[model samples]
Target: MGGTVTLRRALLATTAATVLAFLPNTAQAAVSYPDPQPITGQQIIHDPTVVRLKSGGYVAYSTGGVIGARLSKDLKHWDDAGNAFAEPPSWWYEYNDTGDPWAPDISYRDGTYWLYYAVSSWGTNHSAIGVATSPSGRPGTWTDHGKVFTSEKTDTWNAIDPAIIKTDGRLWMTFGSYWTGIRMVQLDRTTGKAVQGATVHHLATRPDAPYAVEGPYIVKHGRYYYLFASYDQCCAGVNSTYKIRVGRSTSVTGPYVDSTGKPLLEGGGDLLLEGHGRYIGTGGESVFRAKGHDWLAYHYYDADDEGTPKLGLNQLHWKENGWPIAL
Candidate 1:
């Protein structure tokens, strides 16, 4: 009887071990993504905005003279779709076109693809925002809407990086950089232009902070309008201190507060992401939802090289309290 009991006990122990080996660990399943690879159609693809095409593919547009579409069936391993905007629209160059086309925020609205762009001559106040419409986001077809807005030296700020958000049955644009932080103005729904007599409000500012804040991207989620912008100096190679910061408010107009309950217009921004390892100054951010998950696409100066900026993407996870964290 004792020998039989010993054998049974050993068999039970063996069975437990086998079951444990086959069981999946809950911790390892939480974080899983394919190893990241550099996006195609290079030459500083900064401030990337991605969207899903009607046929179920993805296209991304960014800064520089670098406006090209990428064909991504699964949001990974992209193929170049060639140049989306070959030249600055005549209306834009009629005034000034010195800065090499900065951020391009493309969105589908009113049965058309709207492409909002920025132009400037380096640090001068000649900066302006312009718009172009295309039947599709593909290359070789774009109609210029002329200059939408411009800045003067007296304004004490440069106008660039225009992000359009339609809220409450009306359209609004948020844009600015360096000299005066980020600002927003209401736009006419019919013409898609800034509404006259609409007051532009100071959204966020951090001049005294290490770097200036730019790249204003607004997304409405769960009854809150989240304002995302890049803080600090970007594109300084290894010396770049750029990072993404965010604030949110229930009302679209005023009083955006950070995680600390401090107003962003008063220089309070909750830090979202910064450089890590060979990546430096991960700024120029645009957020998108894909495959039932939110993702952030931005650019960073590569650590492997000295001064080249490359595209970087990471999934954005939100907490129960409604703040976004990069996963």
Candidate 2:
């Protein structure tokens, strides 16, 4: 979900261009990505995952400052809410020297908030995704629950950028990065960790090297499971090549395919959003429902602001064919 400006040269430009070139005629003919809605105050963030709190308003956690947090009472103007944790748990040090966590997914169920995030040093596959619980879904209210999953140097899949989706009474986590793209495993609802002997399902990957795909977020719409993932380089300020793409499948664990019936495992996904105008490197996305509408939350490097990463929010609209468009 993160990389230096140097990694921006990884394999993705051609892949993204190919995908967009083959977009459905309906979409391609009218292809104009929308700009994120304007917002005020504390717009800085990366890899943002958002949740609507029952207590009120919304809380967003992203990659930085002990899981950086932001608050929005009306989903417009935002204020820095401080880090989610006052201090990292002792276990976080095992993965990163600074205990710095990244790419958190927040969900509310059964009267509590569950937060899943990754801890790893840059440019390595040795990583771990951990879980925590919060009573209020606010900063400073979390209780760290340690690792839900991990990936050693020997593992092909890097277990970062964790996102959770519950389907048919089963809890599943989808994660991975440059090593092998997106993967999924069932989680025990009780422990919020991988289920004993669970099979890790391959969800998405690129046909090229460095994979260049990360930050997966899945949501079910109609009869299909839509997999949204960030592709190409990120964290490189204005030089970042990050963009968002999508594919869908009839099953939760898929062989997901883009609008053209191409498998995501083979670098197939419909273009959703990418850097445009002042909004550069539009990726690291998460989707949530609030006030009877679906919204896509992500981060973009601001070309107008010295390439500082900032929050990007857009309403999601599903076409008659069930593909989603960010507006």
Candidate 3:
């Protein structure tokens, strides 16, 4: 889910690269590597989920009114295709006054392209996660499937920030934000909705007051299932403390742990990305596997651009030791 950005924070932090030198705790876990890989095509998006087109191109969808969409044939040149919704769905108005969908997720299921998004207002847990289907994976072709799950302000956990992955021949969705942490439930393969018989499992959380962890994206690699998420404060523009973290477990419904063997439920995670130089608040991410490489898709606030959030992609390289590193 997109966090609320404060206009004032954008004014406070100018050189994100400089502040990391003083984040003592992150020193042991966060990568210190420079962002040397070239990223081309300037465009703006948030919580973007990307799927490669059959034509060897890539299409991305993200959170916004009618859902912002973009396409790229070669990763170097980007074209704003338009919003995924030709007109705002009537259902979204129940949760979001502006009809802006958040944290859109895309995946291929059988012969269909499935997109899942959150219809929710900022700072409130009153929300709904809706599903849509597209035959060609294009913007206007999508048919909204209505609500998959809904959470109220009285619920124990906020339901938002959805990521769906097919593992062990079953589809599972993990979602939550700023409530009781990350939660997962099984989805009916036929309907792509939560299986009524399956139990909801609480996956990860931060025990502190605000418990600032959310945006769960899981990927199975080798024998382990890696869980990635955002941690700390977000949406504060340049002062956004959002960063990506990872934990792993042998089971999909996990007891995931970080590099230090601490359980994710206890706030354990190995830092992946944080603000550095102009790349501020790098989180709300998704992973896509193609060409023998895993690509991380997310958003970052560009300090040079007055903290405007934009899309980001980087290759994940697994070290000989089996840990993933952004190279």
CA lDDT, every model vs. true structure:
0.74, 0.90, 0.82
On the 0 to 100 scale, the lDDT of residue 132 in model 3 is 92
Give a tens-digit lDDT track for model 1, residues 187-214.
7776767777778788888747422889
Model 3 agreement with the true structure over 209-267: per-residue lDDT tens digits: 57799889999888889999999877888989899998989999999988778899998
lDDT of 3 at 179: 88
Tens-digit per-residue lDDT, 93-187, candidate 2: 99989999999999987788999999999999999999999889999999998889899999889999999999999999999999989999999
Residues forming the 10-long window of minimal summed lDDT in candidate 3: 8-17
User: How many backbone collisions does model 3 have?
Assistant: 2
Between prediction 1 and prediction 3, the one with superior TM-score is: 3
> What value of lDDT does candidate 3 attain over all alpha carbons?
0.82
Better of 1 and 3 by lDDT: 3
* Number of the predicted model whose lDDT against the real structure is largest: 2
Extract clashing residue pairs from model 3: 5-235, 17-277
Q: Please provide TM-scores, in order, for all candidate models, with all chains considered together.
A: 0.84, 0.92, 0.89
